[model samples]
Target chain A: MKDRVTTPLGAVTLLLLLVAVGLGLSSPLDVNQGSLVRLMFVHVPTAWVSYLAYGGTGLFGLLYLITRKRRWDRLAMASGELGVLFTVATIVGGMLWAKPTWGTYWVWDARLTTTALSLVVYGGYLLIRAMIDDPERRARVSAVVGIVGTLYVPINYMAVEWWRGVHQTQTLKLLGKVRFDAAPIYGWVLLIATAAFTLLYIYLLRVRGIVAARDEAREERELMNDLQGDLNSLTPQGGLRG
Target chain B: MDKYAVYVIVVYVVTLLLLGAYLVWLAQRLRATRNEAGLTEQVRATSTPGNQTSSRQTPGKRG
Candidate 1:
């Protein structure tokens, strides 16, 4: 029996689904956007989670640099992978929403473009990890990329305001009088959706990080055994080196 | 269903599909890793002290 305990990720995922459907069906639609407002429940949460994932990747990468621990590297890589997936979701959801609202399936708005660039850069970060076989070197390189790639997250958020893009400003902003300007039910749905997605991200991070750590440990053991076998073969006698 | 309703449904559907697929992929990886660990444990058990030399000698006869 080796680490046979079940993970809570699936359980949390089921809960998220129930909450998502509940909100989707019951939340009030926007006056202008009509039923199309329902897309916000999924779109906004995915976008927020994508940013959270990149932020986690950067934070874990910094921790790895400070502590020189393989666990930190594993966490950073897991977050990066999740960030890429969430970004894809965000992009797809946005396009779907935009097609009906903006009358276009694609746009080159500042926010959209910057978000796409963020996806590409972070995606490169994952590719960097895959290209490097040496764990230590891979961690070092990915940590650098992870930290730098996260700079795009803030830029993506601010792109609309700074550059006068077609993509509207965030409904939820940190500064400027905490206002969502939507129905209270819409706000509640968005809040619950955000929490659910955030929980989902954290759960995935934990499970993915554990799996990554185990695989790395297993690989390390195999490598050590191979080295021992080689040493035994090269030795004058059939014994380990003193 | 309205056209906008269809768009919203598609978006949610795609989101669910992508995330669901990711979870499934992670589950598969975890299962495979567990199986590998179990196989490794069985191999270690079989190659106990008494059979270590014989197990090492027959490189082709792996568990």
Candidate 2:
């Protein structure tokens, strides 16, 4: 099972996805929102998984800072990339959900605004990673950004309660009462979708982590070759011939 | 289908397609990297220290 998990997490993710679809379609519609409530299953899970990915990015970033290990940096980058992907999904999903339910595709609601900011901040974090070619320098700078950028997560989560908005309050509150109400079947389906999305994130992260390591190694090799050429060119036999 | 159903289905399709594309891309890259690693190891094993000068030359632009 462990070997299968390591080599074929994507397959496992696909298997789990069957559960998401089955549960989502089998569940009944919301009383108020009608079929529009179906969007909740996809939107909420993508949004939640994006949080999980960003949180992992921050955690790995912190670990990299403490240990000064390249693996942790790679993991952080992998998670951050997944975070950006899911954040895009969340924004798109939210927009679709918003258009039907809220009568508009977007609004200045605190939740929507903060969530957009969260996406932008993490997107910029990736830009920072790309701009710096030196791996260690990139990791160190991105670690700082990764750790600091997570502050937006909580602010985004709390935005609904902090200010009035068209966006509804969170389904699962960190504090205070949980205001979410739906059929037990719907709740279960949403949970399954969340779990499936999280698995997908993990699968993608592993693939990304491997690719990142290989890319970094290739860069190092090329840089070494360049430096070696420079060194050889400086030698008496080579320099005089040049 | 209803308008709301269309929205939901489209959202799901978009999510699945985006993720599926990423997975396919990643799998290709992983395969390429594995092949590159094997080739690198073969070169390292065959090359001798004395032959370093010949190997030091950069490949042609077509490479």
Candidate 3:
């Protein structure tokens, strides 16, 4: 049978995801919010993963530029794309929950605005990559953008606490004192969701790497073919007919 | 399940659909890349005239 945990990294990630889901599902729902609070199981973890993925992209971007490794650039691009997806999910989930709780679909809160800004910055990073034609140049420019865009993740997270914002403060923080009774099953569900999403992320990253490798090989072949054609056309008759 | 049940269901469904679509796209891409890699290998093998004889003579070491 194929190894379910093929790599050490995969095994460790799977374990952590299982733990996270277990913790999330087992934790009882807040007495105030009822079962709807269970959405936090998916939302909070996805938001965390989104930041982690983007942060990873920034790091890989740095590695790509420093080492001039195409693999690093490919991984960075993949991470950023996944980050965008999770960010969208976070925003949508938050909005859906907010409409009922906050009585508004969206609020011009500091945290919300900053989070939105962070999304835009990363979106622009993708656009910059698309605009550049040369692979090396594109990688370099995107690396710079990726590194610069990461500054906003912290800002997005801390905006509510730092400023007067409509967004609520984080309850899962180490320093927070708010207490709420949570169900046991809630933690398990969260753990499961986190595991599933992390696995999905890993699977996508691997696939993206394969695609990038194929693209590089195709480009190299095309260049070689063009060069050969040019050389063939330049050669006169049989040999150098001066 | 109350008035807001529909909204919650809609959100879940939409998220699931998006995730499923992405997975399908990724699978298609993986298949395409594997196919391209196979084709490229085949072309490289056939394009080299000397390799053809060697490949036929030493089937064990071809790969």
DockQ of each: 0.63, 0.52, 0.33
Give a tens-digit lDDT track for model 3, residues B1-63.
Answer: 345545555666565566567768877977887798889889788769776676466566757
Best by TM-score: 1
Q: Which regions of candidate 1 deviate over 4 angstroms? A: A1-6, A236-242, B50-63
lDDT of 1 by residue, B1-63 (tens): 345666677678888899989989998998899898889888888799987787677667755
Best by DockQ: 1
Best by lDDT: 1
Ranking by lDDT: 1, 2, 3
- Which scores greater on TM-score, model 1 or model 2? 1
TM-score of each: 0.90, 0.89, 0.78
Candidate 3 docking quality: incorrect, acceptable, medium or high: acceptable
Candidate 2 residues A194-239, lDDT tens each? 8899888888888799899899998998999888889888997765
Listed per prediction, chain B TM-scores read 0.71, 0.59, 0.65
Interface RMSD of 1: 1.5
Per-chain TM-score of chain B, candidate 1?
0.71
- List model 3 lDDT by residue over A40-64, tens digit each: 7767667777887789789999999
All candidates: interface RMSD? 1.5, 1.7, 2.7
Q: Give every collision pair in model 1.
A: none
